[model samples]
Target chain A: MPALVLNNISKRYGDVQALDGINLQIQDGEFCVIVGPSGSGKTTLLNIIAGFTKPDDGEVTVDGKPYNQLSPRDRNIGMVFQDIGLFSHLTVRKNISFGLEIKKSSKKDIDKRVEEIADRLKIRKLLDKKVRLLSGGEAQRVAIGRTLITNPSFFLFDEPLGNLDANLRVEMLTEIKRLHLHLKKTFIYVTHDQEQALSAASRVMIMKDGKALQKGPPREIYNNPIGKFVAEFFGVPSMNLIDGTIIPEEDGSLFQGAGLNVKVKGYSQSKKAEVTLGVRPTDVVVGNQITEDGFGTINSLELLGDKNQIYLTLEQEKSIIAVTSPEVRPELEERVKIKLKENRIFLFDRDQGGRLYP
Target chain B: MSERIKRKGKIPVNIIMLLPTNIIILFLIIIPTILVIWFSLVNFQPTFGINFWQSKFVFLDNYFKILMDDEFVKAVIRTVYISLICLGVEFTIGLLIASILTGNIHGKKILYPLLIIPIMIPPIVIGNNFWLIFSANGPVNQIISIILNTEFKASWFSHPKYAIIPIILSEIWHWYPLTFLILFSGLVNISTSEIRAAKILGATEWQLSWRIKFPKLKGIITIALVIRMMEALKVFDVVHLLTHGGPGTRTQTISFYLFKYGFKYSRISYVSAGAWIILFISLLGFSLALRSVLVERK
Candidate 1:
C-alpha cells in the first residue's frame, strides 16, 4: 500500500508559486528523497508533508486518510529540522524524554526509553549536560533522538545533515540510513545535495523551479536525466553542456550538435529543432590525438586526488571537462584529443531546456 | 625580527584607538564614584576646607548618627515596600500584556501608542496628575460616591497606607512598558523551529511555552527585573514632587530624607552619611538579586 501521497499540491506566496502541481506517492517503508537547488520548493514540500504548512490547493493523504486535516501534534510524524533545533535549555536526557512526557507516559517508562535512546545514540554520559555545551554532532544526535522517541510512523528529515562538518555529515548519513533500515519506517527526506540524495534515498526526485524535472533511481537519473536542467545538475564537474545546431542528416533524421554527429535516436516527437549537446565528464576521454572522433585541444588541467580533470576547448570556443587517470594528465598548454562515447551523448531543446533525443 | 616589528606596531595603534573612550569613561563614571566615596568619610565643609585632606576626621560619627535615627529607618522600609509592590504589579501585568500584544490581534498598532502614552509623560507630571486624582474630593471620592451613593472623602496623603498604594501604582504604571518591550522581544526572538520541534514531539502548547520558551527567556527576564528593581529603589522624584514627605513623614523616601538633611536643614555631614547608606543598601540588594537571578545555573 502507498504510505503517503501528495495529489496535485500547489502553494503560492503572493505572486510567486512556491510549489506548482506536485504529485508524489511513496510505498510503505520506502526511503524517498527530494533533491533540488535553492528556491526549488523542496523544503516547502517537506513543510507541507510535516503539517508545518498547508497547501493552497489539493490534499495530502497518509495511509488513505486526508493529511491536511490532522494537526501537527496528531500527525504522529517525527521531524529533524535542518537547524537541529534542540531545546537549548534542556539537558540531553530531558530533550529525549520530552516526547514521552508529553504523552503522559509513566515516569518509569519515560526513564527507560530515555536511557535506551541515550545509550544507543552514545550520549549517555552527556545526558545531564545542558544542550548549549554540546558539540555540533552531539547536538544533532540528540535532536534525532528527541524526534525518534515518539515512535513515529513516518519520518521527515529536512536537510538534517546540512549544517554538519563534511566528516560528521557522512557519519550522520550512515547512522540515519542504519536507523531507517532497523525501523523500516517510511522516510521523506529533503536535500539540495545531489550526492547525499544519490547515496541515501531509494529513489530521487529532482526538482527545478518548483517543478519535478525527473524522478528515478539514482543510476538511471544520472545516466538518463529527462531535462537539460536535471542533466546539468547531477555528477561532479556536472554534465558538460555545449551549444550547437542540428542539421539535416542523410536518411530520415537530423544530426544534432558538433561534438558527436549521429542520427537522432528514440525520440518520437515530430519537431526537428536545433538543440544543445550534453555529455558526462567520465564518459568523455581525454588523451593525445589518436583518432578523428575526438575534439582536440589543451586548455587547463586540475589534479583531484586519484584522477586528473582535463579541460579541453572544442570547436566554437566551447569547453568540456574530461576525467582521466593522473598518469594521463597532459602538459598545461599541450594539445590533447578529447573523445566522446557515442551512446552517452544527450540532446536538449535549446529554447526550453527540455530533453530532445539521445 | 619581522614578526616583532608587526607586533610592536599593532600595540600602540590599538591603545590609540581606545584612548578617547577610556578618557570619557574615566572622567564621566569612575571619577564621580571615587569622589562620592571620598566625600562620605570626612567633615569637609564647603566653607572650611581648602582640600579634602584638610577636613577634620569624623571617625564614623556620621554613620553612627544616621544609623541611630528612627526616621531614616522608616524611610528605608517604605522604599523597599514600595519597590516590592511595584515589582509584583509591573511584572505580572507586563507579562500578560506582552503575551496579548504579541498575539494575532487587529489594530495592535493603535493599542501600542495608547499603552505607551502614560510612560511618555514626564515623571513629575505623572506624580502631580495622580496627586489630584487621589485627593480627598477628587476622582477617588467621586468613584466612592457613585458606587455607594454616599460620599467618602479621605485624604490619600494623610493616610500612610493609602499614600504608599498610590506610589506603588504610579511606579508600576511608569515602568511596566519597559518590561513588556524586553519580554516581547524575548518571545519574538525564540526560534519558531524549536517550538515546532516541540510540537512534533507531541508537546501541547502549554508545555511548549513552559518548558521550551520560558526557560530560554530567562536571561532577558533577569536583565529586565534587575534594571527595574534598581530604578525602583531610587523612588524619589514621585515621592518628592507629589507628597513632599507630607501627611507627617509617611511617604518620605531615602532621597527626600537626604534632601531634607543635606540641603534643607544644612546638615551636609548627616545627609552625606544618609547618601552613603542609601548607596550601600542599593548595592547590597541589587547584587544579591543579580546573583540569584543572573548568575545562578538552571
Candidate 2:
C-alpha cells in the first residue's frame, strides 16, 4: 500500500487555480520530487500534504486513513519550509527538541534524542548557538535535524535549499539525499531546479499551470518526455525544437523543414502533419563533411571545459544547438554538416505540444 | 586653495542652519534645567519677598526635607504602584486584543480603526469621560442600581479607595491602544512559515503562542513595554483631571504631588529638589532597561 495518497486534490485562491486536481501517491521510503517553475503550485501541493493548506475538493489518505479534517499537529507529517523557519530566538538544542517538548516527553528522552540528531547531522557544536547566528549550511542541517528528531511517517521539504549559495546548495542536497537513504522514510521534496530534481529524486513529478504534466523515474522522464514542455524543461541547454512537416515518402515518413530533411524511422503516423521535431543537443552530430541531413553555419560556440556547445543557424535563420567535443571546434560562420540520430528524434503536435512520435 | 576655502566656508553654513534649533533648546530646555538645579540648591520661594537669586543658600536642605516628607515618600510609592498596575493590566488586555485581531476575525478591518480611536483621544478627554461615567449619579451607579435592586449612589471620586480606580482605568483606556498596535504588528511580523512549522511539529494553539510566538516577539515586547513604562511612570494628567489628588491625596501621583507643591503652593525650591530626585530614579530605571535590551541583543 502507498504510504500517502492524494485523490483529485484541487484548490483555488481568488481567481487563480493554485492546484487543479492533483492526484499523487508515494510508496514507503520513496523520494518523490515535485519540480516546477515559480507559481506552478508545487509549494501549494507540499503545503496541502503537510496540512498547512486545505484542498477545495479531495481526500488525503495516510496508511488508509482519511486525514482531510486532521489538523497539522494531528497529521503526523513533518515539513521543512523554504525559508528553513528555525526559531530565531531559540538555541539549536531547543529547536531540535521542540517537537518532543510539545509531546510532553521526558527531559531525558528529549535530550538524548536531540543529542543523537545533532551528532547525526554533524551540528553538535551548534547545539548551544542561537539559530540566527548559524551559517546557511549549518542552519539547513539544524532545520533537517529539527524535523528528523520527530521521526514522522513522511517528510515534506519546500525548496529547503533555495536560500543557499550554489556550493552550499549542492553540499546540502547531498546531505539531504544521504539522510533520506539512511532513514528510509517517504520524502516529498519540492524545487524549481531541474538538476536538483533529477539528481536527488527517485521519482520526479513535473508540474505546470497547477497541473502535474508528467511523473516517472528521473531517467524515464528524461529519456521519454510526455510533451514538449517536459522535454525542453528537463535538460540543461534544453532540447532544440524545430518547426517542420512530416511528409509521406515511398520508404518511410520524412521530417522536412528548418533546413533539415531526416527520415522518421519509428514514427507510425502516416498522414502528413505539422509537428515539432525535438532533438537533444547530444544527438545532433556536427562535422566537416556534408551529409544528406542538412547544413548550417556555426553561429556561436560556448566552451564547457571538456565539451563545447555549437549554435547552428540553418535556412530561414532557424537556430539549433549541438554539443560536440572540444577537438571538433568549428570556426565562426563555418558551414558544418549536421546529422540528427534517427531514433532519437521526438515529434510533438504543434498545437497542443503533445508527443506524436516515440 | 580657493576650492579648500569654499569647502571650509560650507562648515559655517551648516552651523548657521542649526543655530535656531540650538538657541531654542538653550532657552526652553537647557536654561530651565539649569535654573531648576540651581533652585534646588537653595531655599528660594517667590513669596519670601525677594528675587530667587538672593535666596538663602541651603545646600542639600531641600533634598533632606523632601526625603523626610511623608507625603512625598507616600506619593512616590503610590505612583510606582499605580504605574505597575496600569502596565500589567494594559499589557494583558493589549496582548489578548492583539492576538484576537491578528487571527481571522470578521470585521477586523473595521475593528482596527476602532481600536486606534482610544489612543487618538487626548488623555485629558479620557479622564473627564471616565469621571462623568463614574460619578455618583452616573451610568456606573445606574447600572449597579439596576443590578443590585437599590439606588447604589456610592461616590466613586470622593471615596479614597475607589478614587484610584477611575484614574487607572483612564490611563489604561488611553494607552492600551498603543500597546495593542505594537504587539499586533509584532505578531504579524512573525513569519507564517515559523507558525506553520510549529504547528507541524505538533504544537497546539497555546504552545504555538507560548513557545514560538512569544519568544520571537521578545524584542518587540521589550520595546513596547519600555515605551509604555516611561509614560506610565510620569502619569499625571488623568490623576489630576479625575481626582485632583483628591479624597485627601489618595490618588496623588508623584507628578501630581510635585505640581501641587510647585505651582499651587509656590514651593519652587522644594519641588525642584523633588523633581531632581525623581529624574535620577527614572534615569537609573531607564539605564537598567537599556542594559538588559543591549545584553539580550548580544
Q: Give the whole-model CA lDDT for all candidates, comma-separated.
A: 0.82, 0.90
lDDT by residue (tens digit), candidate 2, A282-328? 99998866465999899899988899999999998999999988888
Q: Model 1: residues >4 Å from true position, as ranges?
A: A252-272, A287-291, A302-308, A324-332, B1-58, B100-120, B128-159, B292-298
Per-residue C-alpha lDDT of model 1 across residues B1-298, encoded as one tens digit per residue: 4433236436666577889999999999899777656666677555444356676668688889889999999988888888878878888888888888877799899988887776688999989887888888789779988999987887777686677767777888888898888888898888878988998887787887788878888888878888888888788888886678877899998878888776776666667777888888778866886787656564
* TM values, all candidates: 0.86, 0.95
Candidate 2, pairs of clashing residues: none
Clashing pairs in 1: none
Candidate 1 lDDT, tens digit per residue, A151-214? 9999999999989899999999999999899889999899999888889889889897788778
User: Residue A178 in candidate 1 has what lDDT?
Assistant: 92
